[model samples]
Target: MPSHPSPPARSAVVVPYAPDAPPPQLAPLAGPDRPGGPAVPERWNAVDRSAHAPHLVAVPGADATEWIAAALVTARPGTSYLKIVDALGDVPAAVGAVLETARRRGLAQVKWEGWTTTAEEATALGFTPLRTPPGAEGPDSGYIRRLYGAEPAAPPYYAQTTHFTCGAVTALVARAHAGALPGEALDRDAELTLWRAATNFPACEPVGLGVAVHRAWPSAPVTVFLDTEDPVLLDHLPEAEQEWRAALQRLSRADAERSGTPVDPRRLSLPEIRAALDRGGHVLLLVSLATLQGFDVPHWILCHGTVPGAVVVDDPWAHAPAGDTWVDAHLLPVPDASLDAMSVLSPARFRGAVHIAPASTGP
Candidate 1:
């Protein structure tokens, strides 16, 4: 896949609040049209309209008085992830209300990018700082609070250096889990080398990525699953690009064979991926980021475990601030249904996956 252009950063719209007001009582705002509520800002409205399942939290004055703070939030469509997009007045109180609401709603995680609370305040409220990806600067970084008590051990996170290198990062994450590479070794030098070895440069194919992993650690077992029945990109690309893609696939297969890695013709299902994680294997999944971030691009994510109703993922893109904090993309919970939809690329309608295990595990 060609490198995707980075999306423009969304600036946080900060609404000024009254300097002095009585401490407020936090509650869920009934709807956008609740009577006697604080007026919703235009940015909040925009986010609400665009979000998957939007909700509002309000900090009303004590004794059923007046609205002191309000915020717009939504569950990331197809996932149990909740994001706090915009707020007005008493941000901390409003944030607390949102967190409570999310807990009640059974959301797995909560992320707030433009938080007004200090580190101490956020920690006191159960939020851990989120990390920003390397070489990317943003002000929207905030905290991530895991609602579920199940915290499975996960491989070290390696943020992609470029938009197109997520596949390589996914591979590195898998390698870290397999004990072939240390998580701290995923620096620029390592990333570039792995990118060159795994990617068909600009387009990282499943087979090619597996081949690179096998070559790097022959002891580790790698299984590459390609959706041969579905000619996803081939059906949509221009003739020249299609031919280029075909050549790349052919080369990737050849490399896999030469490197002694196993290439299987299979389309993985949700259960299979979950089972793989259960069996102590990490998965490098090719998914569409549009499902999560509203950007239509081929992306890669690492699956390490499964909760009761969601898959735990380590996304390579750190769109948050707080610079390498706890919730940047660590153990994110995506509902099974949403993961299924994201697994199949749009229009292209094909799925790709790579399962890797440590040397001791047999295929």
Candidate 2:
């Protein structure tokens, strides 16, 4: 009898996945029980690490029966950042193949947000060392590589120090991007200072945040979009507290009007947002963390720019469980549909956005 022929080597494929729930496209295919089903570990299951990623890059063996290597890549405007969540079998050797896959997807760079992976291991795979000095933005954890010469300049990443400071941090980051503040000035102290000025106790409302922005930088044109006049960011508080907070929101709105800030009582659509970015404006969008982080809490993120069919954002909070770093949060490329869905808060069914004109162009 003739010997059985070897199976051809299989190329890597990007598979749609969500850590919290399966997307509609994969409706019928249940779990690993399905034929040729995915073998994604819970750790690599990226739900919302900023739009472009959490998708699987699976390379199969020549026999096409077992995985040769796999990883989760979060897409950015022109780059892809890998989370430390999962890497199976010969990951280092698979770098070239991964880069090829990324190239086909229009990516210009590939970087590994180090979890347990080392610099030597990354450098061995032709990746440049990302070990930044004591207090820089380079990967203190892992390494990175630029496939193409240079990539689109993305705003620097600044992680929120405390859980309740996302909105304040987001606004401050927008200021930094606009050259109103320095990247090095973004610290826990600055974070709390902005938080104190903007927070509605636990959360930051768009109107209030916009008011704070004008106070900090009067030159920056501030425009706020909110669909409701009712008190928001207070649904989770006690009824009595909700009333006071609601009063505060009304006061914030009045203050905004008095300060000559633009307040539009409607949601800012994706197209409108993209247009703002094109005009050199940074938008602070309030979103629900549920779609990406599994938390149903209201969150705030900065919309910096747009790519092909995606809007770029910088989410302050990194999902630590997935071992994410600044690489995952900075310049995240979220599709239009996802941002629209996440921007509409439940119970309230309202949307909130704050637009800031180019306050300063000088760093």
Candidate 3:
């Protein structure tokens, strides 16, 4: 867990909410200023609401002996890593209860993004600093406790500099994780370069992105799954724009064929996505941001791990103004059934995905 900037200044103000099972995901600890505008930096207004909205939540302990004040860090629905920024309590039960409530409601996973809690009490509550990404453990700083038994391994987070390059960024992250590209080299240049290689002008068609990854490292074994042969990701474009983009997609399909990148016509089911990951593969999943985010548009995310009934994905579009950070994007859980429905890319309801596996061995 790399040290993120500490959450905004905390006041003891606690908002009243359901103390027992369910809790509102948005009630952030700080951001006295709500509405955050667009893409602003260091502003927590996106999640904050109203001038008097209390950032802290008081969850009564199981025994009802004490009321624990917790800062609900990331308030996302089923497909997010719900985070509780911090909680003031002798025991972790207060925040722990929040986590349990989130899980019961089918949030993919949860994190205790510490702000005020001490290491002794945090570790005692099954909260731990992340090591794969270098949690840099100890009480001296904010250590996260990821709830749910999902693995902590995450490809380093890379925020998409441009709005439409999520597919490119996602493929690059897969390349970095599979040792095809230096993780440190995943900068703006790399992002645009890959997008230029893979994009059908701007939107990343599945075949084009797959071809780019396979071309970057042939041994990485890229396979794309798209249900339709007709040009996709061009529905919103006008007639002439759709014509050119559709041509580019056909060319991409040709490229994939030449590069030996298999393009399966069948839709990649959620179980297949999980199976690829279980075999130690990374997936660039095409999804509509409507269910995950408020907007309805085609987006790409990297699927790297799986929990009990869900698959974990690392999304690249980190909206800073929305009070979203890499912590929000990094390896969050998405339930199996929900992921199936969210992965669709068009009005046609066909979904897309690219599976990249480790280099094959044995002649």
Best by lDDT: 2
Candidate 3 lDDT over 288-328, as tens digits, reads: 87766667888999999888888888888755444445555
Best by TM-score: 3
Instruction: Rank the models by TM-score, top first.
Output: 3, 1, 2
TM-scores, in order shown?
0.76, 0.73, 0.77
- Candidate 3 regions exceeding 4 Å error are 1-57, 60-68, 88-93, 103-108, 114-124, 130-144, 150-152, 361-363
Residue pairs clashing, model 3: 1-135
Task: Write down the lDDT of every candidate, Cα atoms only.
Answer: 0.67, 0.69, 0.66
Task: State the TM-score for model 1.
Answer: 0.76
Task: Encode model 1's per-residue lDDT on 9-120: one tens digit a residue.
Answer: 1222223222132123323442355432443343343222333445555655663456666765654456786666554556666666776666666878777654334556
Output the lDDT of residue 351, model 3: 82
Writing each residue's lDDT as its tens digit, candidate 2 over 1-363 gives 223221122477567556666443332232365422454443344334545455666666665655566655654333333433334455653465566665576553566766545767676665555433224332466555554443245676777878899989888888888778988788888989988888788788889988888888888888899999888878778898889888888889899989888888878888999988877888899998877666788989999977666677888876654445666676666778878888999898999998887755410
Candidate 2 whole-model C-alpha lDDT, 0 to 1? 0.69
Model 3 residue 302 lDDT score:
94
lDDT of 3 at 207: 93
Clashes per candidate, residues 3 or more apart or on different chains: 11, 2, 1
Worst 10 residues of 2 by lDDT: 1-10
